[model samples]
Every structure is written in structure tokens, then in C-alpha cells.
Target: MTDKIYNVLFLCTGNSARSIIAEALLNRAGKGRFRAYSAGSQPKGEVHPYTLDLLRSLNYDISDARSKSWVEFSADGAPQMDFVFTVCDSAAAESCPIWPGHPITAHWGVPDPAAAEGSESEKRLAFADAHRMLGNRVNAFVSLPLASLDRLTTEGRVREIGRSLSEAG
Candidate 1:
């Protein structure tokens, strides 16, 4: 097998919650095989507090997590991503900058935990649910036989993973 490290970018309307959680989950679960980044069409300029709390409780490293614009990824010197996933519906619908490598893309929309309206515990539960869903999808992605599969097959698999997860809601 080739020792290729795939770069992935997760996008959302705000880079504060779903995308941020996805980035952390993939970076940890990917075991150095994948490098994950998160960004927004319109970033909130800060990672959401609840997201940070949830990640911390799960023992994930949050030092690198930050709310930034997707433009950062499109600019010169940015890493050329092999895959890109939109974690929110708004971001999936919005037009995005043309990526340099023409990376395979998918939409893995998850509910916005930060948008949950309820008591503190209830809101935290929403974050937990988002975490569970994204974790399931990311784990499925990393388990794919990416090196052996043809490009078309791999792309279809990734898209199917997204669709399956979205439908589980």
C-alpha cells in the first residue's frame, strides 16, 4: 500500500460546530492517514463554546480548532485536499471556490448543535448526538479501501456514506 496521507476539508455555514467536530474526530480517528481541516462560508470567527466543551469532554485536542473562512483553503499555499465534505445543509447548497486538485466532494449534513434551543443539558445532548453521527460517518470513511478502489467507486462510496448517515436522522 502507498504511504499516502489524504487531506480532507469539512465545510459548514459557520465553522463553529458540526465541521469543527468532524475535523477533530477525523484527525484523531484517521491515525495519521488523514489530515482534516474545517472552515465556513461565513465563519463565526470563534469555535463554539459548547463544541469546545464537548470535544474536551471526549479528550480531543482542541488547540488547533478555530473558526475560519473556506477562502483560507482556496488560497495559495493551502494544502491540496483529496476530499471535501460539507457538514451543514447551507454550506452544501452554497457555491464554493474551485479547489486546486478537484477533490472528491460529498455532503454529510448534520443538525447544528449550536442551533439547538433548550436547557443547557438538552443542548449538550444535541452536541453529543451530532458527535455520534459524524463519528459514525468518519469511521466508515476511514475504513474504506481507498487505495484499492477506483476513483469512481471511491467517490460513489463516499457519497453513499453521506446519504446513509443523513437518512439515519
Candidate 2:
């Protein structure tokens, strides 16, 4: 396997939940193989409380997690991403900045747990479900033999992972 580490970016309308969960999942699952970052087109400016709670419960380090703008990734000297995935339908529909390396992009839209309305337990369940769905997708992504695949094949595989999971349930 190649020693190179890949950079990945996850986007959403709000930087509060789904994208943040995705970032955490990929960072943990991909570990030495991939570095993950997240941002929003219209950031909420703060992460959702439940998001932090869920991650904390899962033993994830959230000390450095905060909602940020996608503009940060587009800035000069920003890390060039190998892949970019939009986890929200709204974000997928919006105009995105030109990524430095022309990274392969995909839509891995997940239902907004933050939008779930009901009892506290129900709301938390939404967050859990979102996390589970993203975990499956992230696992599929990290399993790919990226070093042996051509860029086109890698792109196709990533897109398929998103597409297949989005259709699940």
C-alpha cells in the first residue's frame, strides 16, 4: 500500500450534525489512511448539543470540534482534498467552491437529525440513526483498496458507496 494519506471533506447546509458526525466517523475509522474535515455552506456557527453528546458517549475527542465555513477549505494554503461528499440535500444543491485538486465529489445525503421534532428521546434517536447510517458508509469507504485503483475507478467506487447507502431504508 502507498504511504500517502488522503484528505476528505464533508459538507452540509449546517455544520452542526451530519457532516460533523461524518468527519468524526471517517477520522476514527480511516485513522492513518485518511484525514477528514467538515464545513457548511451556511454554518449554524455552533455544533448541536446532541451531536457533542453522542460523540462524547462514543468516546470521541470533541475538544477541537466547532462549526466552520466551507470558505476555510477554499482558502489559499488549505489542504487539497482527495474526496468531497455532501451529506445534505441542500448543500448538494448549492454552488461549491472550486477545490484545489479537483477532488472526486459525491452526495451522501442523510436525514437531518437536528430537524427531528418530538420528545427528547426521539430526537436523540434521530441522531443515533444518522450516526449509524454514516458509520456504514464510512466503513464501506475505508474498505476500498485505494492504492490499487485508478482515479476513475476510485471515484466511481466512492460515488457508489454514497448512492447505495442513500437508497438504504
Candidate 3:
């Protein structure tokens, strides 16, 4: 792979939470390393309000955030993804789109923040945790020598990276 910035897609069932966090983190983390996008296997039709709040609190420019379908990326003219990660446990287990460019796929499931119970603070905590965990993983991923890793090495590394992202932070 050349040193050009690679496109990454993070998917979930809703596209309203985890996948959105992952996308925002990667995109804000740098300018020309990894271009991130997100979608849902079954979109919830709107980006979650809490998701927007968390990003804004961190000063992330999320004015453009919205829930979208993974099918867009499946199109021939869409940005060719170098990596496609399903950020929801449900989406990770469900069927995925047959991608163009054969992007390296991984699963980095984070428990749904919207599913968090209790008070508002507790729900915020869940979002914060997911945001941090995904942020850490995306940070580490972009730091990897993706352009240098060989084919077999990259495939194995993608899984390793996913585990590291899911378990860390």
C-alpha cells in the first residue's frame, strides 16, 4: 500500500452512536492519515443527540454528522475503504456489505451507549467510555505502519488492532 491516506468505515446497526464516535475520532485525530466514515446496516434514521453532545463537548466539529447506510460505500464510485470496522456487537455479528477494493474488515464492538440505564449521568458515562475506547483504538490504528505492512501481516494486524481498540481504554 502506498503512503496515501486510507479510507476507513465504521459500521453499526444504528449508525447513531458507536460507529459515529469511531468515525469522528479518526477524522478529527488527523488530516491526511485515515479518512473515516460511518454507516449502519439498519440505520435508526437520526444521529443520537447524546452522540452529538459528547463530540461537541470535546470540540469535535460534528455539524455534518448524520446516520447513513452502509450501502453507500458499497457503490463502485464511493471512497474505497482500506478498513471497514463494525462498531456494534449486533452489526459485527450480522451480515456485511460486499465491499469494493476489498477493504480489510474488523469488529470493534462497544456496548450501546443508548442502552445504558439509570440517570442521565450514567448514560453520559457510557458514551464517554465508548468514545474513549474507540478513540484509543483509532489513535493506535493510524499510528501503525499500514503502508508498510504486507498483505498477510495487514490482515492479521487488523484483527490485532481491533482487539487492542476494543480492550484498551
Cα displacement (Å) at residue 29, model 3: 1.5
- Displacement of the residue 37 alpha carbon in candidate 1, Å: 0.3
- Candidate 2 Cα deviation (angstroms), residue 86: 0.3
Candidate 1 per-residue C-alpha lDDT over 1-169 given as tens digits, one digit per residue, 9 for 90 to 100: 5589999999999999999999999999999999999999999999999999999999999999999999999999999999999999999999999999999999999999999998999999999999999999999999998999988999999999999888684
Q: What ranges in model 3 sit over 4 Å off?
A: 1-3
Relative to the unseen true structure, what is the C-alpha lDDT of residue 141 in candidate 1, on a scale of 0 to 100?
97
Over 5-81, each residue of candidate 2 has an lDDT whose tens digit, in order, gives 99999999999999999999999999789999999999999999999999999998788789999999999999999
Estimate TM-scores for all models. 0.98, 0.98, 0.94
TM-score of 1: 0.98
Off by over 4 Å in 2: none
Residue 147 C-alpha lDDT in model 1: 91
> Which residue pairs clash in candidate 2?
none
Q: Show model 1 residue runs off by greater than 4 Å.
A: none
Clashing pairs in 3: none
Best by lDDT: 1
User: What Cα-based lDDT does every candidate model obtain?
Assistant: 0.96, 0.95, 0.86
Candidate with the larger lDDT of 1 and 3? 1
